[model samples]
Target: MSPDGLCAHRFRHTAITRLLRARVPLRSVQRYAGHSDPQTTLSYAQAFDADEAIADVEKLDY
Candidate 1:
């Protein structure tokens, strides 16, 4: 059990993150997360700051 009493839920979040990173369909992620609607799954997707992504990309030229 998690300190917040959401042990299983943490795994769900991790699964959702993995699916989002893999570019899986949002609808498919909704089904996997057992949400009745895609919007709910979409809410869990990581929010990317464009500036951060660009900075990270620039660092990859090593």
Candidate 2:
């Protein structure tokens, strides 16, 4: 039994996040996630993009 509620929800979120981070195809991920809206899957991709952007900014000569 899950100590906290929505453990399966958390698992799905983590799985989707990891899949996105692994650069899986968006359409494929959407199918795996069963998301009707691609935007929902894209939202996870934005986080990965933002993280890479942050790393790039850190390398600035400033």
Candidate 3:
């Protein structure tokens, strides 16, 4: 369990989503995820679905 008592996977997704939300750069996420290149980590970001893109669009606040 996480510190917040949520599933550990939730934290994983949160981390990736947080990085995406911060516009931290996919290449940076790649390095952070210890991926050979940005592509691998990119797959993780899309592993669940296109939620990151959806979240970003929802944040438009328009």
Candidate whose lDDT is highest: 2
Number of the candidate with higher lDDT, 1 or 3: 1
In candidate 3, residue 47 scores what lDDT? 44
Candidate 3 lDDT over 1-62, as tens digits, reads 76778997777767876786677766666567676744455555654357664554454433
Model 1: per-residue lDDT, tens digit, 1-62? 96777887788888897886776765566678898855566666657455643443354323
**Tens digits of per-residue lDDT for model 2, 9-39:** 7788889989878867666787899987666
TM-score of each: 0.60, 0.62, 0.47
User: In model 2, where is the ten-residue run with the lowest total lDDT?
Assistant: 53-62
Off by over 4 Å in 1: 1-6, 48-62
Clashing pairs in 3: none
Collision pairs in model 2: none
Residue 46 miss distance in model 2 (angstroms) = 5.1
> lDDT, candidate 1, residue 8?
79
